[model samples]
Target: MVLMLGFVTIVAAALAAGYLLGRLRPWRRAGDWAADQVRFTGAWVRGGVVRQAVVVLVHVVTAPRTSWRIMRTPAADTTAPVPVRDPDWVAHRTRADKGGTP
Candidate 1:
């Protein structure tokens, strides 16, 4: 039980230290570089097949709805016209409030 507790403590301390170090700018940049390198290596290994598959998958998921919206004509408007105040109403109010002629 004591040995297990010690091991857990050591792991917790290591994780905390790693988290702190990862928050530093240099460490963060290094991590990003490593991640990019890994991604590049993965893409190189998979060749064009994975890239084409990803494109096809994205198109299959998104193209139908977007293409339909773009190609389809809009429905005709049938709603009643919205009521709006006359443009001269504000000018009349301002003149009346300033003691000018109605």
Candidate 2:
């Protein structure tokens, strides 16, 4: 009887938590969560909150430059290739050459 009661209580608690989360779903989309997560420590963070903030700050500033330094830039092509032949102009001729077809 006690085991059955304990199982019932755990299932009831799970359902209650699920119901509460479902009711609060609309409030979750109020802002960009990625930006917020980057700017500040999560409420779940306990003693190491300040250290997390410093590490995230260092990443934000230095990582972009380090990535840029590794990137390769395209070298300019200084000269254009010389054209060898005249373009075909068969359609644009004002008169047909010897035949009725242009």
Candidate 3:
């Protein structure tokens, strides 16, 4: 009977741990998503014709001339952009998507 109780307790703990980790998955991804957005925005702001020209000039002026290897890599077709929507808009959209009148 005590062995059965021990087994039940272990099963309960495993289930509780699984539930907590499942709940944490979204929060972990949210942090990563926010970081990606910030990096993308920073890169967008930094990238411009002027920056490109400066980079070109620096490369040209450097003494050791290096041959650029232009590799034609296939574009990423799998990853989709994360949709940014207001909480209220999301709630409405969720309801609308479910065929409920929002």
Candidate 4:
């Protein structure tokens, strides 16, 4: 069909334009500049990721030692009663073991 031929012509023209632009001197310089910008952005992101990974690795490596130190401290009390946030809920339940009802 004529429409299909027109579409093919348009695609071929676009390809030829792209090829010429890619091969020409000024466009090649522009392409290199664009590539450098992408390279710099990628490097920046990579550096940030590496820096955060190092920070996480440090925390992971020191966590056990930090926990052990806190556990061994004099202020760490094991015999303290843990306070419940919902102590009143026990009164509403049935105590089958003690033969008590709600």
Candidate 5:
């Protein structure tokens, strides 16, 4: 148990020393470099997450049922109105059909 404790203490000291050395390193000294790295890394991850959400949203808008036709691309039909299902009526009809009535 004493040997294990000594080993743990040595490892912790080494890690702390290494961390201090990295902080004092010449390349890590520039405030702008650190700021730029932080900004760039943060922007990369943030943009990735936002980009994913945009892709999903765009896909949802472009889905067949949504009929949210794209203005970026050519329209599928110039005159056909987009479908907007009435949920209450649809549910009522579904119940009637299930009871063997149209």
Candidate 6:
């Protein structure tokens, strides 16, 4: 109980000191300066957010059209047999492409 009272008294005293200091000229000026800095930082953050949103919007608008163009294009004919110069390298390449132990 004594400890609790001590804590409450300390909190009240701190609050009162803060209230009195906030009324002083220097403290009020400091608070205003801090608020201005916060506002400046907030504006920068908002600008970055807006720029990211615009980039995402552009990607959203272009992605489907780009994908559709790719899909509509004819695939190249690859029926001709290409001779592998090195069978060992070809086996390793195939294994790597399949994401197996290479």
Mark the 10 consecutive residues where model 4 has the least summed lDDT.
30-39
Better of 1 and 6 by TM-score: 6
Model 1, 15-96: lDDT tens digits are 9988887677664464454445333456534657775455434443445564355348585689768998788875657766
lDDT of each residue in 5-92, candidate 3, tens digit only: 9999999999999998898886556445444433355652476877545444443334123313211345468988899867786555
What are the clashing pairs of model 1? none
TM-score for predicted model 4 compared with the true structure: 0.27
Model 1 misplaced stretches (Cα beyond 4 Å): 28-102
TM-score on alpha carbons, each prediction: 0.26, 0.30, 0.32, 0.27, 0.26, 0.26
**RMSD list, candidates in order:** 16.4, 17.2, 17.2, 20.7, 17.0, 20.7
- How many residue pairs clash in model 6? 0
The alpha-carbon root-mean-square deviation between model 1 and the true structure, to one decimal in Å, is: 16.4
**Which candidate do you rate higher for lDDT, 3 or 6?**
6
Among residues 3 or more apart in sequence or in different chains, the pairs in candidate 5 whose N, CA or C atoms overlap within 3 Å are none
The 10-residue segment with the lowest total lDDT in model 5: 62-71
Alpha carbon lDDT of residue 70, candidate 2?
A: 31
Worst 10 residues of 3 by lDDT: 63-72
**Cα lDDT of model 4 by residue, 5-94, tens digit:** 999999999999888876786644544544443335454346677754543344334454653564477864666687877667667556
Q: Per-model C-alpha lDDT, please? A: 0.60, 0.57, 0.57, 0.59, 0.57, 0.60
The top-ranked prediction according to TM-score is 3
Displacement of the residue 83 alpha carbon in candidate 4, Å:
84
> How many collisions per candidate?
0, 0, 0, 0, 0, 0
Model 2 misplaced stretches (Cα beyond 4 Å): 30-102
